[model samples]
Target: MVAVRTARTLGLALALCFFSGAFAGVGTAQEKKAEKAKSKLKISVPQDDAELQIEGKATKPTGTVREFETPDLEVNKAYEYTFSVTWRPNNYTTLTRTKSVEFKGGTADINVDLTKADPKAPDKAVIRWVPTPDDVVEEMLKLGSVKEGDVVYEPGPGDARMLIAAVKKGAKKGVGIEIDAKKAAEATENVKKAKLDEKIKIIEGDALKQGDYSEATVVLLYMGNEFNALLRPILEKQLKPGTRIVSHRFTMGDWAPDKTVPVKGADGDEYMLHLWTVKEKK
Candidate 1:
């Protein structure tokens, strides 16, 4: 998990497990005041050196009950979290666990016992893959109002065209999480070819699983409706208020978007784009 942000960003902070960076907020007074009282998470297992990494929020811990605190979180917001446990003595076979929770602003105890589920379970793809074109990416970023200081992330960044475009459009940084190993390599190469090797980071991992976009200001998506539906609760819980989400051709089941638009693709095909802003859960 190396980052253009800094090589040691993850090496030291996450012990070469996962690496990421953060951005400061300059927002309305209410938003500024909400940046305290983080959610509390504690993971319990038999291993004292169990490396625990959660989804969405980014602070990996190691201990019997790996305890950590999240950054200021939205109240009544549903977020998806993943617990990635690695027992080095066992040859580093990773056990990944995912859960969705609605936390009110404050220190909510999220105690997870990883012993319950099989630590070696595999994951299934949640969405059929579809790549977003560069022009369509431009439209989505514009639709989401991606600009300077924004950090963009695409969960299933196919070839990373979306992130490459975000960096070019003045976004400070971009991250792409691709589940396919070959595509992830292809994306890394593409970013390098774009000379955005430093600005864009790629991860070859499960997109429908635990991963953090906590630093993201704008998130772009191109999954199907059901996939969006499955990810909606987690998105709402994990993304800070005011963060913009734009999906290329699908909408969250009943969570109406703030705006929706259609853009004609270069191939004479039309695509539907839906934009949603994370709101505090009522």
Candidate 2:
């Protein structure tokens, strides 16, 4: 009887071990499956010396990484990351700006090429404040064929009227940079009064020195001929292909416009608008 009982007890212990091992294997497979469901983030930069920082109130980035993984992030959830990149483009300019990027799906790719990023040259802020009238704004948009979801940027946005108008005309977003503090403040107030604070953003900074409008799908300029000429090279290098730029009463030096038209303003003054679409560089 004792031997029979011993054999039965040994069989029960062996069965328990086998079942526990099978369950453990399933748990390991489940962990591996969970690992595969996490998302990934990748950032590409021109130089190894370049630095990229994702700026948020509680957010911190490790460094300029070629590959990053978001194992904790929920699947299919989109997250917006604003980055400040400081890099010397071929030892050119130490460019820095707060720019946004949307990360979704299983992977996110961010490419940083400052070949024409921000013209962060330590030059004096050349302020030639030329305000664009509402009629001129309308004409400029008409000339550029501004459409919905277009990003409009005005470098020397005097009072941000151009940006506000662009937003009103159905552009997705508008950004205005003004060198003068008073004008920037006024632009802010004007945007607030128009109830366009959500759609238009005004930056109190130098247009000549600050050059991160690379996101602009349509650039509206009211600068002088000389300023526009000086800014031509930077715009050419930075702006993406098929991007449209329109200037009031000025021209981009050697790079000729796709079309130039004369529009009479509500004030009865004729304005010369020049539109240029960025093309492949030779």
Candidate 3:
């Protein structure tokens, strides 16, 4: 009877061991399946020194490529992946490029070439040329309080109409920085036609690199939000106290406007104007 009981007990222990091993194997398989469901992104940069950010989170690069792993995603659903790279090439200005791509659940690759992504390229205007309506321009100048002895400056000036009007309104000088050569010539010709060439000057260059707006008593902008953001640092650093910045239909990011006004353009469209005044640096 004792021998028979020992055999039964040993048999029961072996059965329990087998089931435990099987459950452990199942758990391992589930873990592998969970890992397979994750999404992976591979980014390739032109240089190793470039700063990379994925979804606003800073990522460290391994050589020229960085492999980023994300949580599990729905197989058929598309997701937007955004990344930005900041790098300064030898003898060139520092440039930051942001790109977004729609990606499905899988391994994805992105290549960033800084040389081709330069925003200051002569032919590559960041913002399209949209002329502010005559009535809107008048309102913008008035909102900026441009008057005699004021040096009015416009960046990405579509035409010199705003500057001509500013000078005619008793501004001492008007300066326009235009990126496109053709537009610059057209604006210069327009100034000559208005007989204000002596008071107004149109510069053919990239507005982002101009760096000098210290003389501007009133700055006028009709650029988009992105362009305004890129110019904000330069404006704050160079513009003097009491200088007024008037933007038509766009505001600098996070920098609240001192005053905002709404005007009806002659085209029967309502336009918004934002004004920011530079305060004395404490």
Local distance difference test scores for all models: 0.68, 0.65, 0.72
Model 3, 32: alpha-carbon shift in Å? 40
Per-residue alpha-carbon lDDT of model 3 for 41-143, expressed as tens digits? 5677757887776556565544576565554443434556556776654332355677665555444443434334444432122566788888899999899
The TM-score of predicted model 1 comes to 0.56
Candidate 2 lDDT score relative to the true structure: 0.65
User: Model 2 compared with the native: what TM-score?
Assistant: 0.55
lDDT of 2 by residue, 1-282 (tens): 111111121121211111112101122343345532333345555456656553322222334444434333323445454445555533213444445555543444435333234444332325446567887889899888888999998887878888888888899899888877998899999999999998898898877657686898999987766567567767877898988999988787777888999888888888899999888878
Off by over 4 Å in 3: 1-41, 44-125
Q: Give the lDDT of residue 216 in candidate 3.
A: 94
The CA-based lDDT of model 3 is what?
A: 0.72
What clash pairs does model 3 have? Answer: none
Name the better of 2 and 3 by lDDT: 3
RMSD (Cα, Å) of model 2 = 18.3
Worst 10 residues of 1 by lDDT: 2-11
Q: What TM-score does model 3 achieve against the real structure?
A: 0.60
How many steric overlaps are in each model, in order? Answer: 3, 0, 0
Q: Weakest 10 consecutive residues, lDDT, candidate 3? A: 15-24
In terms of TM-score, the best-performing candidate is 3
